[model samples]
Target chain A: MAKSHEETADPSIYVPSQDEDMLKKQKKKEWKETLVGYAIISPWLLGFFLLILGPILASLYLSFTDYDLLSTPNWVGFDNYINILTSDPRFVQSLTVTLIFVFISTPLKLIFALGLAMLFNTGRKATGFFTTIYYIPSIIGGSVAIAVVWRQLFGRNGAINDILNSLGLSGLNWIGNPDTALSVLIILIVWQFGSPMIIFLAGLRQIPGELYEAASVDGANKVQTFIKITLPMLTPVIFFNLIMQTIGGFMIFTQAYLITQGGPMDSTLFYALYLYEMAFEYLRMGYASALAWILLVIIALITIIIFKTSSKWVFYESEGGR
Target chain B: MKKQNSKISDVIYYTFVAAFGFVMIYPILWMIMSSLKPEVEIFGNAASLVPGEFRWDNFSRGWEGFGGIGFDVYFRNSIIVTTLVVLGTVASASIVAYGFARINFKFKALLFGCLMATVMLPVQITLIPQYILFHNFGWVNTFYPLIVPAFLGGQPFFIFLLIQFIRGIPRELDEAATIDGCNKFGIFYKIILPLLKPALVTVVIFSFMWTWDDFLAPLIYLNNAGLHTVTLGLRNFMDADAGTNWGALLAMSSLSLLPQFILFAFFQKYLVEGIATTGIK
Candidate 1:
């Protein structure tokens, strides 16, 4: 049956006249369309090759060598990576600080976002106004100006300490104390919970009303319904937010650069900020390239781990009755 | 009983929201008020929302800026870079998205997968090499490193966003245009571009906001004081040993936030919708 279908489908083999001409013309048109498609997307295609692909490969190559900004790279295989892993105290400190920030701030941010989303999802009046108000921080969160304000707000004699003093409680220097310095940064991260909250709100909107109605009919309380219906359905969105927020947490630069400068004992020394210092400040371009690659690997590993575990919890409406 | 319970719940909900809202908004309010406060009065009256005396000197002083460069120069530079970035992002992303969404081509799926992978790849991975590449091209210290990438569809997020939006548009419209003697470009220009207004607005707002608020890119690229952006200008206000001019800093910070505040206040629907659609679907 396949052979017969192939024989009939090949029009040029039997219909050697107008039919063949038409087929050729049709094929030509498709080719022309494809060319036009490529033409339309040429900018991105060119960018992908030169800007993204070339740089990625170049960075990988540079990671294997020692190149300062002043001189050509001297080939030194695996030394940078080895030093980073075994000897560099600052690298270890930065890695630890970043991991702590990511682990602490991401979950806290997600929880705050989820909570706010749930609160707003309760059919309140003027939700639009509330969401907008909540979202404002996220808009200006990464600016140098905000970082400066954050510094002042947590400074020794700043607004936070002033409030503490008025309340009859002694205030420590929030930004100055090593123990609380990282916490100030984390607070900044958690404060910009708008994006994830909006995503959660969108996810909540997608939950079928019938599920809630059915849960209520079955005598399930609000908490029970949330756990059984809402949480399960929202898992996919939660997973997405988790991955994005985690990646963002790793690449955090501006806040630390502006607010802390990886000081107060390098408590808030983010990986990206350290990388910037290496490349720009220390002029260790090759070492920074290696650091960048390590960051990439770390992010990729985390993303893979999340995706690998997602099948267990992420619910898809299309995969119902499973 | 149910009505009374709901009323009680509503009151609690509003109170909770109001309290949290105050916390969220207080910092900004404080910043604005501090900007207006007298220099000595700023730290002295930190706990008070009301300024002891409104001082307009901070604004003038801040606007004068550090060194010879002023806020006007930084603002102009920001506007120039941001405008070009927004324009380039929209044009390139739309064109690229149209190709992905509407056209059938070889390696399309593979290319799209690569784009998605790149989205997850942290910018740090390519930062050094791109910097070096730009350095080699003598593009560093100029806006080329920042602005040219936008023209080349450097942002995967915006492209993905536009693709999602274009996919939502009906293919039947394209087919109708095709029948009316419109080529693919014509179909795009006449049909898709008009319908892509909302997504385009979202892209414009986002690109503008991100570029305006971006510190890292400008920090790395613009080494010249005259070419500094507003973010960089604000950063120069800090002197580690001498202490910051809090009044001037707050004043400039308030000014820095004004454009974003205005944009968000007016086009909030687009902003929320953008985040919702981009993230969820």
Candidate 2:
């Protein structure tokens, strides 16, 4: 191994001219590296073809066929797509519910995360402890058990209502009511904003201390310093969080499934949750496939829009990229 | 004048932050407390945060049996599945990430871009077909479906994360190694792998948590009770639609969360580093 290291070093890195023996050794090393690289990447390559790409294309094909678990798919081109778009009321409801969730939850989560990150950045002692406490909810928030606990806490006679009664207030049946069930899911999303908060904290750290000092020396008040210095500097991180949280929010399912089970007149029926119901309960494999494709297009469009708009506001540290 | 206002603001801030913290944690704390309280105490004084009696038996009972099936079996299954998935995700994701990060190849950007697209595709999109594919292979009711994909670089998000981390390592190290006659493979193993410990640990922790917490995959795949993971086992503890043996269920949930919480608490620095490294850049 060390011998190749000695052999391949160009006396002049930019110059290509070299000895024959050294050239031959470099070729041999290149061959070895290629072999190793292939070996290392084979896991992804194998997964790409077998698990990911295969299922994706298969789903596309499955979308045009009437297939159930019991039997082979019979080709039915355009029917699945047509049915979902024109005929399926459930599909429309699911899409509406999903869009509402994405719009509400993503913004709320971002605001919560940004606010917490700002507070923590104010040089508090035991910052790690507070951050960890906030993050623990995120770590376990999506678990089925947590969802069950959510259900219990929000149920008609649950702890939340119990507290309201103690305060001499009339208790509303939260989970049982359609209007409030969606709010519960949104609240769940917001509570788990800790991951983004931590990321924002890291982003905050990256804004040089010197900049704040300079702003302070310039006699800028704290609010001005924050607005002028911190917000602009944190925009990139915020944008990153926005993209990720949007994608994540658009795929919300577990809370819907475990907590409300898409109940109270389908108010909490998340897109993914509804898709699961279609695929499993109704055995609408083809229709579900079509729904999945539509979701993919929606996500792709959102991501593309983000990238397209990024140049206007995103402050890249480097100018190297064309 | 400004200092005094700021102090008042600080007090307001602390109050707001602490109150929100309490609300966020109240359910979790309530769950833990309820797990110790017997069934009668649960509804009798539901608003109370503390249990009247510490039912150590709740843990023992939850550990032993619920609905004629012992949690021991489910616990074993969870451990086995989570451990394997973590090991598999770390090994595969790191290797694949190294390949993407370090190795120059034909169509490299295209392939990496394709992998990125995979990250945006909803997992539910592939759920039906993947189940069909696995079912055809007789993988249902087995750990094969749950555990095997991790070894095959299952989670693209983790791979993307590791790829970013591996990119931050100086390419000069690879060049330096090459000058000393160390091949690309040698550079990856000897030079890059050590540098990726924090990222790899992050992948491991995420894989473990995801697999352990996952309900949909296990719900669809595992038909047998004995083969259930904790997520499935906990769901089964529910009587029909309603969850029974509230104390035991809460106890089991709390117990299930202990492993991940303990791991995170111990290695939090790595988690923080990993989150920053992956997301900030």
Candidate 3:
């Protein structure tokens, strides 16, 4: 732009060589733009290389070796992976716990989220206040404070039992029982339905009113309307919520780490919790790196699988229909 | 008859809403009320919202933190880390977003794709390597590891959030600024940043809350009780195997949530907006 202004301001007879000079100037300007672009994004460029990419590759390499924090990493060449796949009982245990947690909690959480979201999305007045109140848990749900309170509420002499006794019913040590321990965590996850609920609300709002109106015009009942128009339209949001929650569920650490300490017989040992213990608590950095890589693959595979299958279920409007 | 039916439905809806809302916030209210309860009644009167007698001693006791350090130290560490993180996230995210949204460079599409991909890259993937890097940097036991990456690029979500915003700031404004001799950087602060207020505030709120809530980093890096953030400090305050003062522990736990509660009270609009827009986090 400055070059154009300069050219207009010159208002002089152009020499033949001026064509080459103008082209050169244009090329220089393009080069300058590139330089400025890189300069502006230099921080991210530095961070991506140093923090994310470097660490990911280094972690992958470390997964192949056995290195405690003290000693140099000893390359064991697939031994760690072999043990994780073939032999490690805790690895199997953690994976089983994580898979169960993800599969159970995700659908239940989404169902609550979708059900509540549909209820909130009604054009009825004054629902915003209730929505806000309902959303409070998801905001602070992951905090250590809430996890602390959650532990107390289910403890032997805690509030849950306190209420149970007053109701003339017996109460078990909910946190200490292996059978109920994972269920307690699942309850905690489901309780914070605020996030996916809000996302569902947004998705619900995006749906065209005419779709429902058209269904009503066809004399469709409430259930028919919901199944015919609403469900398909809401599939995309459900898919997004599903992937996000599944990933989050797999990475659940603090609650298990703090509330259950990954036990009553390792019943609530989430994968991330186990990885943390391996690396930091047990100082098995290399083995933990292997665990981390396995987690990375698991998440990647899950995300990819969901995406691959999404075409069959996810109703994208731009694609015009399933 | 129709009016009566509608009226009955309205009553039912409100009743359901009130009951569910109460149940949703019950745990939080219980914690807050229990924080003020005397030790005997804290457990004894577990289901009661009203303590037998209000006790302020719990706060003072909790404030006298573990290892002779106080809650003030934890709060100070959290405040320092959160403030720096929020600032760094906003600044770096906005600048990087402007570059992607407004400029063209070699590998621009590829780089933009990289940014999008990193959003799904779990922090655990980098956990060990990052720890090793910081350890080699002599940054262990310091705030450097916790604080530095934030200054570098922060979250990819922040960058993505701001990129959407910058793209919406009509290109005419940038051209106008250019004609007035504003360079790219000049156009950024002068023409773009002020317009980016709401989006930047969103980044600020999210980063502040996330960094404040972050436990694993501080738990791993800052083992020294003196250097622990509130989240880390409170986690240690009540050791699972050891008997903890439940009164003091609940008191501090409730107190630790104050900043986020305050932020929520003030800026829930931005928080909700950010979440609804992204839907990933």
lDDT of the candidates, in the order given? 0.88, 0.83, 0.89
Q: Give the per-residue lDDT of model 3 (tens digit) for B1-281.
A: 99999899999988998899999999999999998988888677777888889899989989988677888999999999998988888889899999999998889999999999998788889999999999999999999998899988899988998899988889999999999999999999999999999988888877888899998899899978889899988888888313458888899999988988998899878778777887744
lDDT of 3 at B240: 35
Report the C-alpha lDDT of model 1 over B9-104, residue by residue, as the tens digit.
Answer: 888988889899999988888889999998777788786789988899989988988777789999999999999999999999999999989998
Evaluate model 2: give its TM-score. 0.90
- Evaluated with DockQ, which candidate comes out highest? 3
- Each prediction's RMSD to truth: 2.6, 5.5, 4.0
DockQ of structure 3:
0.76
**Which of 1 and 3 is the better model by DockQ?**
3
Instruction: Put down candidate 2 lDDT per residue, A162-272, tens digits, no spaces.
Output: 899999997888988999999988888888888888999888889889998999899999899988888878878988998988888777777788788898899988889
Worst lDDT run of 10 residues, candidate 1 chain A, spans A2-11
Q: Taking the true A–B contacts (Cα pairs closer than 8 Å), what share appears in each candidate?
A: 0.70, 0.57, 0.77
Choose 2 or 3, whichever is better by TM-score: 3
Give the Cα error of residue B269 in candidate 3, in Å. 1.8
TM-score rank order: 3, 1, 2
On a 0 to 100 scale, what is the lDDT of residue A114 in model 1?
Answer: 96
DockQ of 2: 0.52
Question: Which regions of candidate 3 fall more than 4 Å away from where they truly are?
Answer: A1-17, B240-244
